[model samples]
Target: MDKLRKALSGRDNSDEQEEERGNIMTQTEDTPLLRVMDNSTLSWNTRVKGFAICFGVGFLFSFLGSVFLFLPNGITIFAVFYTIGNILGLGSTCFLMGPVSQCKRMFATTRIIATIIMFAALAMTLVSAFVLHNKALALIMVVIQFLAMTWYSLSYIPYARDAAKKCFGSCLDL
Candidate 1:
């Protein structure tokens, strides 16, 4: 049990000097957020689980959208999915707080821009599909969302992988 606790805490007996630096620096290494973002052994597992969760949620939303896409009020279903996804996304942002705080000056504006574009696409989809009830416009919004997602994946994923590499050394698999 003690071994398990120590391993989970991410401490090495050889790193006693780190503890003297300060509580925040010492505690940060063991934080779950940091582990998710940077730990070589654990980050990949956490990322896989997060990907699964996002995929499952997205599948559910897609299924619902397909089921109601033809109905007169079908767009509302997609709107609900958008709302739920947004809420989930907001909750997930908490995981980034530690990393963001630790390296505020390092964050790239491109990442922020890509994220904003993605959110704008979501908003466009919700407004066009649900509020305006314009199927064609909604389709356009979806295309925009796809493009935004591609942009974000290209820009942010590489940045995150690189950051993880820097944090955990080249051995970090991201």
Candidate 2:
């Protein structure tokens, strides 16, 4: 025990000397915010889960769109459009997370413009089909189009923002 104590005592003195001379970097071993951004950064496992969920959801919707596109009488075209848009939207949301939130205002305009154009085109198609007496088509189109866009935007945006904010920080010490 004496020998062990002596060894530990010697090592501690060397560390203390290094610290005193500023030759060693002192880490904040007790700082709670070392890796956490705003105290809400997710754990590694949570980030992995979020990425997996986004990828899986996007793939599922895109595959569903493909299947719906091949249905008889083109009845499922609306479903196809909706699924396609949402899949793309989800993917884009994941890609452009940095820009979607208020942190990056420059890209917000482009994101908003593209979304409006996409939804407007969808609405126009629905209107044309309804006016031409294609009730089945119009029903499929309008319901899915509106709901898919709304659902994707509502569910994905906040999630992306949170994840991005956690992964990154509003300010960097560097």
Best by lDDT: 1
Please give the CA lDDT of all the candidate structures.
0.57, 0.48
Q: Each candidate's TM vs. the true structure? A: 0.50, 0.37
Q: Where in model 2 is the C-alpha error above 4 Å?
A: 1-41, 77-81, 84-107, 122-174
Best prediction by TM-score: 1
Candidate 2 lDDT at 93 equals 31
Positional deviation of residue 42's Cα in model 1 after best superposition, in angstroms = 9.4
lDDT of 1 at 33: 63
Q: How does residue 119 of candidate 1 score in lDDT?
A: 76
> Per-residue lDDT tens digits of candidate 2, residues 1-174?
545433312335665577677541244453545433211244434544655676667667656655665666454454445545454544543322211232232235535644555466466555655465574655555565655455335432547646645556745533
Native-referenced Cα lDDT, model 2: 0.48
lDDT minimum window of 10 residues, candidate 2: 94-103
